[model samples]
Target chain A: MSQLHLTDEILMAFADGELEEPTAAAVAKAMAEDPTVAKRIMDFQQSRRLTRSAFSMALMPDVPPELQAAVLAQVASYEADGDSKAGSDIKPPQDAWIRRKRPFMQMALAASLAAIALALGYFVGWQAEPGTGGLIAQLESPLVHHELNSSASGKDVELPFGRMRVISTYRLANGSLCREFQLRSSTEAAEAVACRNSHWNATFALASPISDAGYTPSGGGDPMAAYLQSIGAGQPLVDEAEAKALAEAGR
Target chain B: MPAGIGQELVALLPRLRRFALVLCRSQPLADDLVQGACERALANAGSWTPGTKFDAWMFRILRNYWIDHLRRMRTEGMMEDISMQTQLVGDAGEGPILSRLVLSEVQRAIDSLPQEQREVLVLVCAEDLSYREAAEILDVPIGTVMSRLARARRRLMEMTAAA
Candidate 1:
């Protein structure tokens, strides 16, 4: 038989185990004969693996109790009706519940964004003080510098305002050592990013409420979140890698 | 209708939500979609075949529901919300920002694909559905499924390589 001309679709199907047996045998023969064919098959397999792995953590939120209750309520309603078909035309609780919930969600989102803006404006007043060139000279305080360089992710250090905690440390794609920190005063809290060069400097800041247990993005349009994305920050460092990154920063 | 479907749906909740997230790209919307799909599934329980693939059947219903939702949104002039909400990718106080960064990067890449390719990619690669099963769910020919899968993988590979 003439050498089987394998298109990408055939190779993909062969990798996916979707090809017929004889065709699969032919592809196997092609793979064995041609190194390139094997690599193509491997590429297809790798793509499948990458997709599977990416979705392994596919931003799944915990199932809300209301949703569970709604589902069970639906089932219960179905069962309660002697004829399930009678319930078939009824509107789902989720339909009404979500309709009622949407406006509230949008309002909450708008309120949070406004609060973040107000906070950013308040925080910007500090930058206007005479000689500081738009960046907060936070590291000029040796104690703050020491804490930022050596503090573990969850450690709390007392700041003059209230309290400061390093949320995470990671390297930007350009190999800059950056730390995400939350500064909580008695009344207000904000998450800020600082990266070190000759010294540490605050890069971006967002006003976040002190009420939340963990830092959350102030909705999608916030600047600090965009900064994180633009800088290509990878996953926060694990303990060992964090130490190594800190050490490399000459701590 | 089946004896264990309630429990099965409970078990499948996370995966269904994940699939909805991949399609809808918004947490609140995905939750609503999954709940609605579950409600529909229960209300139409008698139509489900007893011994067939339960998850695939659920997936088909969810996918059909999503298409209908898109149509409804278009009719209501609400199509802008989908694009605006696409940027909202985190699990809302669930995971650390650390992992969310990496995951969101992967999500951005996946999000860049055309919707047709995205649906096929997620169905086959993430859900682990067979091509034939996906074809049946998508109401497309098997060849069309393979072609879409091929294009999606190739685009993803090129993206990974460039990144």
Candidate 2:
């Protein structure tokens, strides 16, 4: 007999409980008889079990029941506020970090231009291949002193020219790692932190601008804000060594 | 629209929440993401057209958001790994809760899958979406979904089997 090759859609239909009773029964019977088919079913079941387990916890976050009510209430309020005004356009604080990030990028761009120019001058003697400069740049990055340690705090900071701060210290479900941080006072201003793992992730919180200065961190009662204040100017946020330390620290 | 639609949207939360968690495989982040999705859905409530499955629409939004999140993640220097099969079973869970062990292994195993395959698994197994519906949400042909899913299932089989 030609071997029966089960398609994923069939397995999926079976997995999702989408198969009609008779068909499902047949699949069950077949799975029981064929070890390979049985294994496939188990794998699908395992995948399902995993997804359910992970997401199930996320759903019931013990978000203070009152907080849940509050979030919903806030939603209602936002809908009501939609027509009354321009709507809360508070451009999340991370936008400030994003804005602050602009200058260094321009610097990096300028550096690239300079590097290219130097490369061209040095290679002028030969009709080199088109891809030469890239290879040179790659080799040269290691020669420079600016190093990023993937093993540091599992956290690293990136500021255009100014300073930033750490946000949360938590290991991600994935082994990659994560850290949260914010930018302190700046006129083009705001708050928020960026997270990253040893791999160089920089995830910024949703855009939330800095709240008014009058509201003390104690008054605001937001952990994110109080933490930013506690860090002081948030300057010298993190260096390469510290970054590596955070990475290795596993958070 | 009347409040009925709003209530309907709220009703879908449990299922949607389940889908979000499965995709991200992290409870805390999953909750955050679901909250973000809810906020976005409500904020753009006016844009929802009648006669469409809100779940489907929300799934699309969630899928797009996830893609964006992944793109943003790429800039952070994510590494790719291809581990040996023998070690797969060696890492199986050892915890108080039997379910937790199974669950954690499942989560890690799912994570090992390529992005394409993982989405298929999420759609078919986690979200209970039909192949055709998954096709629409993923913006791909039904066959493509099937192909990716087949490949994903194969990979999962490889990763989960005892060495």
Tell me, by DockQ, which candidate is best. Answer: 1
TM-score of chain B of 1: 0.89
TM-score of each: 0.58, 0.41
Cα lDDT over the full model 2: 0.46
Candidate 2, superposed: residue stretches over 4 Å from native: A1-70, A78-251, B2-18, B21-32, B69-104
DockQ numbers for every candidate?
A: 0.22, 0.08
Angstrom error of the Cα, residue B37, model 2: value is 2.5
| Worst 10-residue lDDT window, candidate 1 chain A | A92-101
Binned by DockQ into CAPRI classes (incorrect, acceptable, medium, high), candidate 1 is: incorrect
lDDT of 1 by residue, B79-112 (tens): 8567567633545554563255453334567788
Q: List the candidate 1 regions with Cα displacement exceeding 4 Å.
A: A57-59, A86-251, B94-98, B101-105
**lDDT tens digits, residues A1-251, model 1?**
76677999999887766677688789877765655666566557656656765666434456778877887787667667645453343222221111111323323322332233333332321111123222233434566667778888988988775678888897887888999887766645666777899788766665433333332323222344445655667688979999888888874
